[model samples]
Target: MSSGPSSYKIFDVTLKESVAMTPSLQHCVFYSEDVANMARHAPDQRIKVVLPLAGGEPPCLVDNGGWYPAWLALPAERRPPMRTYTLRNVRPAQGELDIDFVRNGDNGPASRWVNHARIGDRLQLIAPNAAFDGNGSGFEWLPPDGVRQVLLVADETALPAALSILESLSAQASPPQVQAFFEVPLCTDVQALDHYTFAKIHWLPREEQPHQPYGQSLLAALQTRLQIPDDAPRTQDEAAQGILRPELEQMWESAAPAHSAFYGWIACESSGVKALRRYLIHSCGLQRETLSLMAYWCHSR
Candidate 1:
């Protein structure tokens, strides 16, 4: 996109490296000559990617500023698979960015690309233009300014984002008391992650003898810790937005009262998150404003 004169632009990026991270995560580094124009707007900075076709990964085309509309106009066979991912790090000076991919050994487009990607393979990324002074969206880790106790729940898909939030929190003057429940595919997937001193991380592996649901461990953990009252009065703000409805395809809400001492962030499979949304608000009586619930993926069993 000619180095992007607009607030956001498409960049042709090369796969610099694809390396292993724990048992379930793949760390990929992409570089582009135009990456120097990309700027990180938030710790949970996310970018949209056009996945390469099978075999040798090739760079895909993004049609102008209205990327989606143009792509949708293309023939079904010509249309490429597109997905959103969080950035692990951005090195504007080096024209490089890192992303953590959760590898479930599935035949999904992303996992297939990761399984076959070569060092020089190419792809497309849409990211913020460094020169833009405007605000960027696609980030949801915003808690109240001085929140104390924080609850983080995620499966492998959202683990990278959860860790990114913790990293951002660590930089604060007085970090919150973070209790993070990270569920992964196996015990070996549990590894050391950088977090603040007050943060206590609990890793749940799916290797348990009796098979449990993906987010069940996190929900059970929270049930014991949080005091879910018999009822919670919803504010007009929440009621107006249908925040009480968990049947939506996915949920993404981030609005916490400034006076709140504790804030919860939950992201995982669609079904699990829907159940969590219901329990946290209706059953547990948690104020809708004190929590941010995001359904990251829907697994079709």
Candidate 2:
């Protein structure tokens, strides 16, 4: 997290392969000599992807903890667009990493690049330095000890992280009961994923109810499944149209509940996250510490 051996490093990586897992999801395999030292400490491990400059040249970067300031110090013209994403899978021995990109056409720099990304394309990844002591730099999937039920929710943007968490939980000796609600652009966007018997995945397709807002399907499913407090207000869209929290910064919080038997990890649009955070805590009486409600993105520019 800082200038230390156990923190992070920027690795220059080349895309070795790309597969269209779904129309909206691209599974890309990247290779780098230094990736062998990249650590996957948590299921939902976050990392930064530095996109190429206007001419498709590798963006200027510093391969150390000082990358952020150093990158910002560069002239605006030289500052590449950096985006956050989850590491789906990591094969340290194979010197490879897997990242799933949502192919949202021109939504932002990452989407634009993934739309045109091809084998041999190169980028910079700021990830954990496994070469030294283990560090949870960009990891955030921590549930309370002995949690009985885990609620995992996400839209297409956070699907990579939700799936990664599911896989890791399944490997546990005694996995908790998991109820996952994943909303994608369409049913076709759903892919076959690996999970355990205790995991019940409910894939909500916005296509069925084309009239509803993008994240309504997920919210409806959650309400129907979970118990809302008697005093909880009827659910409404919370997409941050008025803008209380910024998309990337105020959108993130990850601390497990100290005493609750249930834990939740929810990530979606900013307003939805805020609305749900309020309902779960104030309305439903879910402890503020019982969840990691993250706004993975925002609708605003």
Candidate 3:
């Protein structure tokens, strides 16, 4: 299959420097000759990063039946171990790009590189790739005109996508009320993002205990704050409603009374997002076309 016209571009960017976006978040401002030649990207687009791991670091991209073309044809040691991250923001006019890295433990090379990234750090960035139309605002399920309310959900990995979505929605002819949810390990993990929108943002901190189930806790808090109703059917419907059924139902009900259609973007753990998608489709009766569910980082990926 041929990529008709590559929506993604590859660039070599030198990190002029890094800034502490928050106690747990760092902003890496990078520049590239390639970035200067690229075209403007939609707000929700993302890029792929090719990270070279240190010796003895476990290869994150494995030789799996040649399934990953991006990593194929390279010597094992020098092969780029790639990770996809949302483009937090782009200042095409200034020829600068921003990507936020959560200061999680450096168990992985990407995390390690980000933690120690500094001035003159070299990084390769594939050009911004347009979002899958189905999961993007371009999808038919999203409000064609304007909505009164919107709900955004994601873990730290998905925060960038959520932020971009909110910012894009803010620029619409008439934007909706936006509520963003993010969960990270540390309370200080929260950071000030590009405030190009008029949405109310909320952050939830995940416990740091090893082996603690952060996914379940996030679902619970979201359900409580959203006031998911107690009248949900207890059997098939409940299970079909997915992990956050009650909360999604509440959102649907509330938004309905105001003639508002919601664009629900949930990107997080693969297992968890499967449930969120189920709730949106099976429980809340949301049109599948309107929901954007992405597994930013999956355990099995």
lDDT, each prediction: 0.76, 0.78, 0.60
- Give per-residue CA lDDT, model 1, range 1-301, as digits (tens): 4644566667788999888988689999998888777887776677887886545446467656566676778787777787878877888788899989888665688777877778988888877778776677667777876577788888898888888888888887888788888878888999776536777788888786247776787777777765432232344455545646544534676755766677788889877787787777766667778878887887867
At residue 126, candidate 2 shows an lDDT of 81
When summed lDDT is taken over every stretch of 10 residues in candidate 1, the lowest stretch is: 227-236
TM per prediction:
0.87, 0.87, 0.72
Quick one: RMSD of model 1?
3.6
Clashes by residue pair, model 2 = 238-271, 238-272
- Rank by lDDT (best first): 2, 1, 3
What is the per-residue lDDT of model 3 for residues 1-301, given as tens digits with 9 covering 90 to 100? 7433344445677787688767777778888655555543455466677676575333344323332454676577667667776667767667788887766667776778888776877767765434312222211124433355566777877776676676677677767666667877677777676564566666777754346454554565555664322331123445544545445532121111223344556677766666565654665556543456666675541
Reference-based lDDT, residue 209, model 3:
38
**Candidate 2 C-alpha RMSD relative to the actual structure:** 5.1
lDDT of 3: 0.60
Off by over 4 Å in 3: 1-5, 53-71, 129-143, 191-198, 208-212, 227-260
TM-score of 1: 0.87
Clashing residue pairs in candidate 1, if any? none
